[model samples]
Target: MAEPQPYESALDAIPGAHPYPRSSRYHDAEVGIHTQPDGTAVRYVKRRLLPPLGEADEDIATHTVSSGERPDHLGQRCFGDPAAWWRIADANPVLDPRELTAEPGEEIALPDGFPGGGGRFGR
Candidate 1:
């Protein structure tokens, strides 16, 4: 019925708000803006490039997918934290996390130890 006010996400209300944790793949992504012909400003996050699969291959460990295995659970089993599942995704070629354990008896590579301690993460 009326013009909308400028959009400021709830997270923007908090000073130094960071939606992604340091361990997240998006932690270092940059924010970008685009302008329409009407001059309205649109903000968005820039595309994030995935690290090459081999980056996480250092000190690699393998786990055979069992029936009903989940990525979060696999992350916990491999890296001690379910939230670190992306680490597993980064080490493999699959674009979807679910594909990591979609088939029973499939082998997946995992980077051992802290993300950046020796692995290529935290770059």
Candidate 2:
């Protein structure tokens, strides 16, 4: 198996709140596959199956960053799920949420509300 890539970990009140940015791709797939020469009569190259990324998301709300805040905190405040901080990160595509949070007034865009009904949304 190929070595795993490291990603930034999210800190929060809950466990497993942070998911690996790109996870289990290598170990979850096959590699070093050898095929018979005369390929047409033998096996074929491998291609990984990918899940659909889904449709575009509309903006639900905009937030003004406040001092000493973290992505997880904003996530909990906005979506009731601290783990959902990635949603905030994904929407803005910023390199660092900590910088945004420390900026103390930077406007951040929040993704659209969750499609399904209930208190749950994009967590």
Candidate 3:
């Protein structure tokens, strides 16, 4: 059997790339290197914006819903408006509104249509 190749850290994988400056709010930014088997290397920078704590917490709540849970139910429970299901559906572009349903361990975006807007539950 062939021995498994050792995994390389992101920093080791890329050359001439350093961690983002501390002054930058996005600490997760890093340089990524892609190399061909023959050793030709290409470097690229990647940056990710971490979500706020509130959004993170809400995402956790969204993940707790079961696969069978209805989208309307999610809207009602999270936003206090069952009709706001459309907003939730809209935010989750990955899922189709006509087939909105949560799967186990899936995180869904919470709808932000709070009463005064023209959104589903808007006044």
Ranking by TM-score: 1, 2, 3
Q: What is the C-alpha lDDT profile of model 2 across 32-85, one tens digit per residue?
A: 345567664442335544322333344345678778889888777766767667
Q: Is 1 or 2 the stronger prediction by lDDT?
A: 1
Tell me the lDDT of candidate 2.
0.52
When 1 and 2 are scored with TM-score, the better candidate is 1
Q: Write the per-residue lDDT of candidate 1 for residues 30-94, one digit (tens) a residue.
A: 87789989999987779987655565455677778889989998767665667878878877788
- Candidate 3, which segments miss by more than 4 Å at Cα? 1-62, 113-123
What lDDT would each prediction earn against the true structure? Answer: 0.69, 0.52, 0.49
**Residue-level lDDT tens digits of model 3 in 4-88:** 2454235434653435422222333566798989999987667553334344333232334475778777666655666656545
Q: Which number leads on lDDT? A: 1
| Deviating ranges (above 4 Å) for candidate 1 | 1-16, 112-123
RMSD in angstroms, all models? 10.4, 11.9, 16.9
Model 2, position 65, has a per-residue lDDT of 79
- In terms of TM-score, the best-performing candidate is 1
Ranked by lDDT from best down, the candidates are: 1, 2, 3
